[model samples]
Target: MRRRLSIVLTLLTVMMLGVIVTGLSFGEPGAAPMDDYFIENSQSESGANNVVTAVLFDYRGLDTLGEAAVLFTAALGTTLIFRRRRDD
Candidate 1:
């Protein structure tokens, strides 16, 4: 048990060190380039002042409805999974 614990601890230390080294290597994404295209397109198409409201209420409403349907389906599936099936 002691030997297993030491081996696991050593492996965990090595993994954490690897992650820390990786963090120093890659920089975070630039903001301007990412937002520019989407901002330009969504604003032109939607015709609304507030971007989030336009996206949610008008432009992407279908997508939101699909997402709601998916959530409803998941809930129904979960309920059905826990339900006792009648064999009559």
Candidate 2:
């Protein structure tokens, strides 16, 4: 039973490593249509000079806010967890 588990785990590890190597060989991904759209229209639609700023604040405002909220919550939780409590 132990030998079987070891063999299975080893095979799984090798398969995962093979997948990673194969993925890396493809190099960087090509841009999608959305990238072109954002580059072209971000300034006119969002009125931001910077494309990145327009995308983050205008195009994906809610998503950015949600991410910020999640990060803030995580930080607060970590702070609370590690806070020193002085027992009276």
Candidate 3:
């Protein structure tokens, strides 16, 4: 019963995620004013020659930091999962 309930819950969660993702539409009107602003002024504002780098490291620094933290946590979790256990 528990296994069946878990399976049903998993399916429901996957379906919900699919619906949510499908509902998200990119390139709608006024969907991305930031993109235009970043492309136009990233180099001037951040003082970096590369617009992409300036945007990533300066304009979106906190978002990049969050990504790094998530990657680090995932890596740590994977390492811990695969590490050998020693009985001392």
lDDT of 1 at 84: 96
Candidate 3 per-residue lDDT, tens place, 3-84, comes to 9998999999999999999999777764798878877888789999887899889988999999999999999999999899
Per-residue lDDT of candidate 1, residues 15-80 (tens digit): 999999888854465556745655667667777777777778677799999999999999999999
State candidate 2's TM-score. Answer: 0.66
Residue 73 alpha-carbon offset, candidate 2, angstroms: 0.4
Candidate 1 TM-score over all chains jointly: 0.42
**Superior candidate under lDDT, 1 versus 2:** 2
**Alpha-carbon local distance difference test for all models:** 0.81, 0.93, 0.91
Off by over 4 Å in 1: 1-50, 84-88
Quick one: best TM-score, which candidate? 2
The CA lDDT at 46 in model 1 is 79
lDDT of 2 by residue, 1-88 (tens): 9999989999999999999988884435545778889989999999999999999999999999999999999999999998999999
Candidate 2 Cα outliers beyond 4 Å, as residue runs: 1-30
Q: On a 0 to 100 scale, what is the lDDT of residue 50 in model 1?
A: 75
Error of 2 at 23 (Å): 7.1
Alpha carbon lDDT at 25, candidate 3: 77
